[model samples]
Target: MLLLEKGIGGKSLLDIVKVVHLTKRIIPLFWGAFLSIFILFLPGRVWAIQNSYKVGIEDVLSITVWGEPELDKTVVVAQDGTINYPLLGNIAVAGYTVKEIDELITRLLAADYLVNPQVDVMVKEYRSQKVLVLGEVLHPGLYILTGPTSLLEIISRAGGVSDKVGNQVSILRSPVEERKIKDNEHASTSVEEKEAKSILIDLEELLKGRDLAKNIYLEPGDIVFLAGKKDTNISEQQVYISGRVQKPGAYEYQKGLTALNACIMAGGFDK
Candidate 1:
């Protein structure tokens, strides 16, 4: 009986080892199949983790290639999205990520007898980050937005809202139609009219401690505006009080307005 029990235990141990080995092999195969399927379903142009630079018209960029000093040059991006390089000569670098520019420079250098070139690109000065502030701001003009600048930051830099107006502001961004218009030159909308789509931002809510999801990163050519909010109170219900009062002008007749105070602003009812 003891020999029979030992034989059963040994058989069980062998079965356990076989099951563990089978699981180890099957798990790796399952994981590989899942990873392959996921990769196959991913977007073709997977954007790398990158820091994008906003290229403005007339912004200067310094490019340096190690071991190839002849290709080093400081170039300004033109308004038409083109840059002049030493050897490449008028390569379009605007709207391209820095990594893309680096790869392009590497290819250019390799063509001209340099192997495995090391390229460095830097923005020496940013002159192209300007946005326009219109409407009820005390000063309305083109304001420069530096790195990571948002709509509220640009508006605050523009000297706040006018005292006479409420805090409803409109941030006008050219609509998607603008892109279509650029693509199709013969589109019906005029250039001036096509540039009219803008997103509205409420500064009053922002001031009132509202969530700031409405405030987004402001781009070049964006128009920030402060427009007046319509007063819902009935004008007819307000009492017109002029003269030497503690607070002059129209007051809500329901509370706080007396005939005696109204006379004060109007020179205190002639004795």
Candidate 2:
């Protein structure tokens, strides 16, 4: 007589064993496929994010060379976007990725100083990229930009807009000629020759996500001004009725009020 234990749902022990065995095989396949996808996609996404950051002026950098103690040093990028390295007097590192800087230093060192040099670079202090936020903000001041930052992001960093803010915001940006001069180009061009341009954004549209294109990315040295409401209530708005008026004081301003009406309201110009 063969022994057959009954299991749940009127299934035999043999049937349950078969289901468990199938599950064991399927689980590995599922995990393997999931890991394959993760491995294939995750690295590229991470690399793209890392490569997007570029060095800028006033940024401090820590650089090292494998097997060369003398080549390791911390350098601050100058206003001109350059750094003085050992055996390499001055190198332009602004607008370059860490990996690019590594390759650049390695190639230069291998040219005459070292053989098969391995180099590494890291940002010690991010002081270069900055923007100024002013007018009608909770905290009006300067902010640092670590990466690609948008106008809305900076405003949030400054504690968001104040309650008295208006419906629009203005951005004053450096002209193209000035930007080119900063990049070590157009040596003869004067920054004063070109006027900075102003960009107005509808705050209502931006905050509501109605028009995302208006939420522009902020650049270094950009100034963001949140204007206050010009059309405030009568209490907040006043007109000076003085000199020849009986009530030689500030009176509440009313729309369409003429000089004669103002004088009449002030008791007919001092009687």
lDDT tens digits, residue span 1-271, model 1:
0000001111110000010000111122333343344335545323421336545456678889987778788888775556877756666665555666677677777877687889987776666555556544445566654455666556556555544345566664532111111221112122232433546556656644484687678765554655533442223343343322234344443222222222343343221
Which ranges in model 2 have alpha carbons more than 4 Å from their true place?
Answer: 1-50, 176-195, 232-271
Tens-digit per-residue lDDT, 1-271, candidate 2? 0111112111101101111000111122333343344335544554553355577777888999989999999999776667889887878777677777787888889988999998888877877666656555566666777766777777767666655667778776633222222322212112332445667889877766688798788866565767656663334445444443456555665543333354457675232
Error of 2 at 22 (Å): 73
Local distance difference test scores for all models: 0.48, 0.59
- The weakest ten consecutive residues by lDDT in model 1 span 13-22
Provide the lDDT at 98 for model 1.
Answer: 63
Off by over 4 Å in 1: 1-50, 175-195, 228-271
TM-score of each: 0.54, 0.60
- Model 2 lDDT, residue 101, Cα: 76
Candidate 1 collision pairs: 172-198, 173-198, 243-264, 243-265, 243-266, 244-264, 244-265, 244-266, 245-265
Kindly provide the TM-score of model 2 when superposed on the true structure, using C-alpha atoms: 0.60
